[model samples]
Target: MAAQFDKIAIWLVAFIPMPVAQGLGDCFHGDDRDFSSAPDEQRFRVRSDIVVSGFLAGDPQETDFHQCGETVKLDCATGEVLARETAGTDGMSFHHFNVGNTFPDPEGGVVDNPNEFCVNFLYDGAATNPLGPPGSPDVDMNVFFTIDPIGRMLSFRGATNAFPDYEAYASVEDGPPVVLFQQKHTLDPINGLPGGADQGVSATVAI
Candidate 1:
């Protein structure tokens, strides 16, 4: 019985020392290996945007697009014009259309240059008669606009069926009309409307 007790004591001493050494080593250093010594990882993420390219063609089915005698105003800031253009047609027309006008640089002062601008007359076949017969001739609409060098619409006048025609110019003798505006062109020797008569004497009609 004494020899059996001695063997049991030896076994316990041997087994206990192995687990204690392992526990001390584990507490000093973690179980995970040094993976940071390897090459660094390169991660990436991507995003996309949806873009619409062209004008909104006129739609006769919708009531907003079919409305007659409409006027629209556009406001542009120091930011992008595309966003401003989308906001401009909010209350005016259902169909979005673009006109020929260059955005004035926002940095430029008001008096630096009169921002060049023009407006479009949108007719989607609803505007056929103007208090007259259905067979009336098609006449171009006139647009009066005031602009700043900051690309802002200060004021404007627009009419659908009643006008002085497309080529009508304000006259001092003719008196003022319902809309307050004027049109005048400054002729310059160096610069004039493109494709105008080069000089006079040598000009010939084209075929």
Candidate 2:
């Protein structure tokens, strides 16, 4: 697979109140499981976001690569984003495939709340998609996230592909996404698409 253009920015967002950032939505309102006597719906503000992307050449695919698009998270209080990437990680390769890295993706989440929200993102090893099991197709380290933050965040429980919690900007009255209910099954813990760009690795007009 060859490389695409410099940067391909894509936003898959569905706001309840409406747009964010440039006059972003004030908050999101909705019902809850306890409709019998539920209180008034709380407003959720855009608390944070995770922007996963790759530059033209020299894409980031290593541990603590700031521009790898997995280093920062939005910080609503101080009006800034928090650092999500941790330096000095013990990342290792499994059969040429790297693993053990954390990447936060809030905007990728569809299930939001005024109090609680699940963080969605990938662990990183998937990005260094090395050759798989002898006969597997050729893999690229900097090309495993063509649909990242769009894939699915791995959780212990949950069913259906929910949005990335890292992508959601909706939060409640200066509070985090509220907890509508607690889901115990099929939680989204896995987050990663099949491909991306960047890293120390580069091909001669190839991925």
Candidate 3:
């Protein structure tokens, strides 16, 4: 069954608490499109130093809650998660999230924060779900980060497969603790629609 955009918006504004897709779409549509003036693969380099991190959190709207309510066993060391619960008839489930451990950096190490780690799951070009097509049950995971002026970790959020699994998005080597992983938009591309331009990425860091 295909998930409708309106239903997803309801879940985002009412049920689920996190950054909603509609808001993101709005932000991207208003930002500048061409990062560099040069056409075709133009590079826009901005020199800046900051620490960043985050994780994934959320299930498809079409997921089956009944089947997802069960507990799924998994290894704590690696990020690999094995299903301990069955997917509901809708083929979707919600998972809880947590932060990862902290890592040690040099006195003044520069951590590059990409404007956005954009993932494009174009459903229009194919006959299946763009993020995780049919036969691929794994949820589409991601990490979003925000850093403070002093380069301290400010906030982090992302997705996971299990409801209560805290180790789903942590780094193998110890890193900083993450905040909450709430439901969010997996993949959306702005196409200069009537209301606004196609949704994209834009970020600003405070010094």
Candidate 4:
């Protein structure tokens, strides 16, 4: 009976279709930008750099490819927005942004310190609809974030769906240096509805 079950499993595996190959957009990095001259000098200084690359299948003729969600940094205690930036239009599949010194903690107030903060990326399919029909497939959209602290530097990378739900919590002194919280729901090829994986990690860095 066990052998029969194994044979059946092998047969089912043979029928499973492979995931389609998707195109990644033009990649970008924040290192190229000099934020010292930004309007908000105090907050615009570069501290954390993020590089992103991915693709969303959209109407090539229109500017739908130019549309993407916003990324934000917030105070963990007060929930106030510290800084925000949009995924710029590069006419390609890739996007990138830098969270510079612009991510400051509450001043002399009772607000939490800079280390107690969180970063988020909001990706809505509705915003991308202008590029393609509803329920159209969007390939892998991902982000790579790096931070420079007093003693060391750390990095993290995560993959997102067409409609991404991403968040990152600052590390506590006693805990890991970075933690990523993700909730991504993507279109199912069979039903055309949202369904996908939910992954989270608390990453510690020694260097």
Question: Would you list the C-alpha lDDT of every candidate in the order shown?
Answer: 0.20, 0.22, 0.22, 0.27
RMSD per model, one decimal = 40.2, 20.5, 21.3, 22.6
Q: List the candidates ranked by TM-score, beginning with the highest.
A: 4, 2, 3, 1
Q: Weakest 10 consecutive residues, lDDT, candidate 1?
A: 6-15
Residues 27-96 of candidate 2: C-alpha lDDT, one tens digit per residue: 1121112211112223211111223223224242322221112223334445354334321212312112
Best-fitting candidate, measured by lDDT? 4
lDDT for position 123 in model 1: 18
- Clash number for model 2? 55
Candidate 4: C-alpha lDDT: 0.27
Candidate 1: regions farther than 4 A off? 1-126, 130-134, 144-146, 149-207
Candidate 3's displacement at residue 115, Å, is: 14
Output the better candidate (1/3) by TM-score. 3
- Candidate 1, 1-207: lDDT as tens digits: 011010000000000111111111121111122111111111100001111111122111111121222111112232222211111112222123223344332234322223222222221111221322234322222232322212322233343222111111111112231222222223321132223222211111110
lDDT (tens digit, per residue) of candidate 3 on 46-78:
111111222222121222111122223333344
Better-scoring candidate (lDDT), 1 or 4: 4
lDDT of 2 at 2: 23
Q: Cα deviation in Å at residue 168, candidate 4?
A: 15
Candidate 4 lDDT over 76-192, as tens digits, reads 445455555543333223222333333322222332212311121222221222222355433233333333332233444444342333233333332332334433334332333
Clashing pairs in 1: none
Query: What number of clashing residue pairs does each candidate have, in the order they appear?
Result: 0, 55, 19, 6
User: Model 4: runs farther than 4 Å from truth?
Assistant: 1-133, 137-146, 155-159, 162-198
